[model samples]
Target: MNLAVFPRRGYVKDPTPIESCPAFSKALGGKVNIFIKRDDLLPGCAGGNKTRKLDFCMADALAKGADTIITCGAVQSNHCRLTLSWAVKEGLDCHLVLEERVKGSYKPEASGNNFLFKLMGVKSITVVPGGSNMMGEMEALAARLKEAGRTPYIIPGGASNPIGATGYVSCAQETLQQLFDMGLKVDHMVVPSGSAGTHAGIVVGMVGNNANIPVSGINVSRTKADQEALVRKLARETAQRVGMSGEFPDEAVTCFDGYVGPGYSLPTESMVEAVRLLAQTEGILLDPVYSGKAMAGLVDLVRSGYFAEGSNVLFLHTGGSPALYAYLDTFK
Candidate 1:
């Protein structure tokens, strides 16, 4: 996937590290070699997978003459934080529509990304219930902003659209290049599958490049069937958007939804355990939501003999660790 052909804004200055995690692997009983692609270390207010996606999304916004940016996400959404962070740097006003996924979850005084949203000086924020029509809301906001004599661009939740996913396609290329330079070939790679852009991007990129690496996703908020379908559709669309020619296998878009405890944004035992294990062993932190659930899924798969013995697995650590401060009771 040659992302250079696409319009992009600078976000990631260099390739984030693909570091070996011998201690983490040993702690998991050494059934397989483990590594982490530290997308969490990406350059931004705080590093995250969204930084890559925004590189392309903001570029499109700029090309469209956007003066203000509008987007939607959960109250503590890392995407919202990063989007606002970049918008401030880009000199564009940002407006956020936060979904209170859990009823009564959107407290004005809540910490975590919520506080950052205020500190970042977002133009405005409208809190809505979970499952709201995010696109419709963003469109309405755009209309109002237009009436006020401002141009607005809307980035869908998670920035998971075909355009934003280009960042992940670029990442797929980067990952393969790093592996080649190190003389390593990984068997499987896992990432948190939320809005499906990251998962779809990697799937399309790997298939297009014939890297032969399977990219899997762990669902943070949806069922397996739903998440897989979304990822599959977006992967096909992304392949078309990038002008890649190939028949992507239907089985390539895999997702696991077992780790999403009671509901979205709620704490779970597996997540708590996984967060502590990784932090204690490898000195890496995962947020209470996405990456924690993803690590839990990866850990369970490893313990259940899901991977071939001695096979190598890579975890895409899509950073959101700062949200841990908002979920202090989970750790306590």
Candidate 2:
């Protein structure tokens, strides 16, 4: 889809690598050949998938002549950390509205992304209760900034809007090209479904490019039905935003919620196993919240024989290993 027609801040110059994980695959009985798209290595303060979405979102903010950036995410949000990082690089003041999705989860003295927030000098940090209206909170913050003579631009949570989702459309294209270059024929793909930006963009990108890869989302928060619907809606909006025409099939967007455990950011035994398995087997670290849970889901799916024997599956590693420090107790 000609994503070049859209404005981007050019934060990502090269595509992340796609590497085989024989050991990890073997751990799952080697029923499928597994490959990982290392998006966790995307450029940012700590590296993450959000850096891609921010590339487009930040460009939009700058284009509108914004002097300050405002965004929201959960406590220890990789998105917030990356947004603040890029804002610092661009000489823009960044404010964050963090939601304690779990009650009492926001700790002022916490490590991980929270510590990075302070270390990077976020202009302000507002912690909201779980299930708070995040956009409303951001709008209020923007209004206050306006009253203070600051030009504030608000980026939605996870940058899941059409403009931000275009970053993943670009990533989808890059991944397809990489697969082609390597002569790899991936049968299925997996990603984390949270704010739905990453999952939605990949769905739209695959459709737009006529790639036959079916992307499955491992839900970190919502139920399968809700997450699938949210992702499908955003995928359609993103496709339309990128000038893609025609109906996006409802069947295209799929999600599995079996791995969310008790709730968002709550530790699960499967998540711990997945994190340790990858770290030990591949020397790769996955953050506790998103990627770890998604990997847990992937591991379960593989064990359950979700794919045909000898199939090829590609997992999108969205990255957030920095948050691992905060979950030391959980991992322990």
lDDT of each: 0.92, 0.93
The residue-by-residue lDDT of candidate 1 on 89-193, one tens digit each, is: 999999999988898998899889989999999999999888899899899989999999999999999999999998999999899999999998899999999
Off by over 4 Å in 1: none
Best by lDDT: 2
Per-candidate TM-scores read 0.98, 0.99
lDDT of 2: 0.93
Q: Write the per-residue lDDT of candidate 2 for residues 176-205, one digit (tens) a residue.
A: 999999999999999999999999999999
TM-score, prediction 1: 0.98
